[model samples]
Target: MIIPFIIIALISLMIHVMEPVKEIVLDRLNGKITYPKTFIDKEHRTIEFDSLHVYRTLTTSGDFAITGKKIFIKDRKFNYTWTLKSNECLEYWSFMVWYMDKNRPLPLGTAFNEYRLQDFERRKAEGFSKPLFPGTFHTPERTPSQHRQRKEIGGW
Candidate 1:
């Protein structure tokens, strides 16, 4: 019993210590260097975007590609086709959307920061103040009752 308690305590301590390190690593990997018209990724690869496309350096041989598109309002998924490989990619995607659109709310699961807080206020002023987490005040729209009712009514 004492050995089990010690093991659990060690595991908890390790997790507590590693959580911040993981967050720091993620922040660096996902962070970008911004300019007036473009930004650079973690590998110092330049990325530029317009309304329709994200142009980025894709190869070490200096080839560039349209790697992604600007996110539109009401897009709930980070990558609709589940193509992105990691959370770092998702963070980059979220940052791209954040950079491109000033009137939209922060993407879901994004942690609040000073810049994002300011943007949230700006978006709220523009009447796009949806909370990042659903069901904050009440049950979400797709609760079990709603699901059952929709099934009963043969709704999609």
Candidate 2:
């Protein structure tokens, strides 16, 4: 009797935990308006980058794509997913726009950085000496001061 009870309890506990896992998995697969999901392996609480720059990258695809999800800036809003093609780069942004729930329209704004796609991170990671937007405007892993000096020197 004791063994049977313990097994039942364990199963119940596992089911309780798995419910959330099931919901999250199903939400992504079934949700119509989901964000792009990135496949980065780093653990972080905040993903930061420039909004204007991200907007520019949205038009062009890099060599690789991250599996990232899109969501609102509001608290605990990792709800939607954006899609990205195979064009990927080392430093890029991928997001999903969830527009299925509310009737309210997304505010008209040139800035799209407000929409954070979960699990998004830099890719094709280069050495510390590598540039961010190499052929474009920014460089990776450079301090603000160093970037300023490079800018003054007209280095790309």
Candidate 3:
């Protein structure tokens, strides 16, 4: 009886610890899991997604593609197709979750657009124009050390 109780306790402890470990492993593999249901834009503006937009487009090959879009969820480009069939519509969260589960690449164009928009906003905030390019052009005014450090440490 004592042995059974000890096994049960050990199993319970393992179950408790496994969840966090799994999340950590997933975070490392997939980068930080951001809940994009609501997020901030480059201009320090809060972008919220109250509802999802679903649309169907016909490809030149005569196949139909179903796509989903949500404000500030992914990038501004709406070219990522979730399904080839238009039988059912999926909301933003559901589509994103499904895509992640299937280990699909999160829309790269959208991510790139967001990054560009953010950079543009940051430059605007700093009273600059023509965009900052690494190893290409230097700014007239010195950037703060903190900002420079962040630039060096680059992550999405």
Judging by TM-score against the true structure, name the best candidate.
Answer: 1
**Which is the better candidate, 1 or 3, if ranked by lDDT?**
1
Q: How much does candidate 3 score in TM-score?
A: 0.19
Leading candidate by lDDT: 1
Give candidate 2 regions above 4 Å deviation.
17-98, 101-104, 107-156
How would you encode candidate 3's per-residue C-alpha lDDT over 1-156 as one tens digit per residue?
699999999999976765331110113123234222212222222222222234444334335443432232232243222232333333433444433321222223454344444543454454442221122222221236534433544311
Which pairs of residues collide in candidate 3? 75-110
Provide the TM-score for each candidate, comma-separated. Answer: 0.25, 0.19, 0.19
| Global fold similarity of model 2 (TM-score) | 0.19
**Regarding TM-score, does 1 or 2 come out ahead?**
1
Q: Write the per-residue lDDT of candidate 2 for residues 1-156, one digit (tens) a residue.
A: 699999999999986765421111212222332123333313222222222112223342385565443322221344323322334432223222222111112223345335411101121111112232223322221236634543444343
Off by over 4 Å in 1: 1-48, 51-91, 107-111, 115-117, 129-156
| Candidate 1: worst-modelled 10 consecutive residues by lDDT | 21-30
The global Cα lDDT (0 to 1) of model 1 is 0.37
Across 38-120, the per-residue lDDT of candidate 1 in tens digits comes to 11223222222331233323323336554543322221222211132343664566554554443333344435443555654
Clashes of each: 0, 27, 1
